[model samples]
Target: MTTDLVVNILRHMLEQAMLISAPVLIAAALISFLLSLAQTLTSLQEQTFTTVPRLLLVGTLILIGLPWFARRMVEYTVHMFTDLHRYLG
Candidate 1:
């Protein structure tokens, strides 16, 4: 295992993680912003108002995106394993 190989592996892992997480994170953030805006407009400051919807939306996004996420993860795992021999030297 060389330094370059380790660095590359780490980089790929992080990239994959970011790619998989970005959609849900982005959706959550957008929903949070919209909820905040609604709260401000309506003077409704209930914590659940923001938290519940965000959670639901995020959950839904994860469920909807699960297949794509799984595929990406599987591909990453396969790629790492397939290239394991190259790093073993």
Candidate 2:
């Protein structure tokens, strides 16, 4: 494949990665922020305070979003495979 093809694939991979991770990251960020606020209010300066809540929230988000993520991934995979001939030749 040419440099342009490689770059295009890399860009697509990055975009897909960002799309898949955005929900989880956003959920984690919100939970972490809230946890931090609570900790600050209570004067409970526990470094690990945000870990469990963030993890749980992100896990729940991942579970809820799994089907949609899988569908999108499969669509991208099929598209890439269908267009493989263009790159391979």
Candidate 3:
């Protein structure tokens, strides 16, 4: 494969990863921030307090959206396989 083709594949992979992960990451960030704010207000600085809920929320979101994420990943994988000959040097 050409350097340009490799770069394009890398870029597309990164874009797909970001697209698949953005929702979970954003949810985690928001949950962490809100938990921190609550901890600040109540003086509860337990690590588990902040961590568990974030994990649960993000996990739940990923579970709920698993199908969509899988579909996107499968599409990318299928596209790559279909273009395998083009990528072969």
Candidate 4:
């Protein structure tokens, strides 16, 4: 593939990756912030206390969004493969 095509593919891959991860990352960040606030207010600094909630929240979010995530990945793969001929000599 030419440099332009390669760069475009790489950019698309990164964009897809970011889009896929954004929800999980954002949910975790918001949960963590809320947990931190609770910990401060209660003076309860146990590591597991914060850890479990964070994991649970993120896990729940991922599970709920699994279909959407899978669809996005499949769409990306199909798109790349469908356009593969353009990159092949």
Candidate 5:
């Protein structure tokens, strides 16, 4: 493959990675923020207070979104494979 094609493929790979990861990352960030706020209000500085809920919520989100995540990954894989000839010269 040419330089431009290599770069384009890498860019697409990264974009797909970010798109796939965005939801879990966002959910974790939002939950951590909210939990931190609550902890600050209550002065409860316990680690588990933040850790458990974040894990639970993130896990739940992953479970609920598993199918969508799989579909996205499958789509990306299929797209890359379908376009494989272009890269193969």
Candidate 6:
């Protein structure tokens, strides 16, 4: 494959990764920030207090978003495979 083709493929992959991950990552960040704020306000320094909810929230987000994420990934994989000969040359 040409250098340009490789770069394009890499850029597309990164874009797809970001698209797939953005929702859950954003949720995690917001949850973490809110938890941190709550902890600071309450003087509660327990790691589990912050961690457990974040984990649960992120996990729930992942579960809720899994179908869309899987569909996008599958679509990308299918496209890649279908177009493999173009790259392989």
Give the TM-score comparing model 1 with the true structure, all chains together. 0.97
- For candidate 5, the per-residue lDDT at 72 reads 93
Clashing pairs in 4: none
Residue-level lDDT of model 1, residues 6-85, one tens digit each, is: 99999999999999999999999999999999999999989999988998999999999999999999999999899988
On residues 13-36, what C-alpha lDDT tens digit does candidate 2 reach at each position?
889989998888887887888898
lDDT of 5 at 28: 100
Model 5 TM-score (2 dp): 0.96
34 Cα displacement, candidate 5 (Å): 0.5
Model 6 TM-score, all chains together: 0.94
lDDT of 3 at 22: 97
Model 1 regions lying over 4 Å from their true place: none
Return whichever of 5 and 6 wins on TM-score: 5
Error of 5 at 43 (Å): 0.5
Error of model 3, residue 81, in angstroms: 1.1
TM-score of each model, in listed order = 0.97, 0.91, 0.93, 0.95, 0.96, 0.94
Mark the regions of model 6 whose C-alpha exceeds 4 Å error after superposition.
Answer: none
lDDT tens readout by residue for model 6, 1-89: 89999999999999999999999889889989999999999999999998999989988989889999999999999999999999998
lDDT of 2 at 6: 95
> Can you list the residue pairs that collide in candidate 3?
none
Candidate 3 lDDT by residue in tens digits, 4-66: 999999999999999999999998989988999999999987999998999899889989999
Candidate 2 C-alpha error for residue 23, in Å: 0.7
Off by over 4 Å in 4: none
Q: Give the whole-model CA lDDT for all candidates, comma-separated.
A: 0.94, 0.89, 0.94, 0.94, 0.94, 0.94
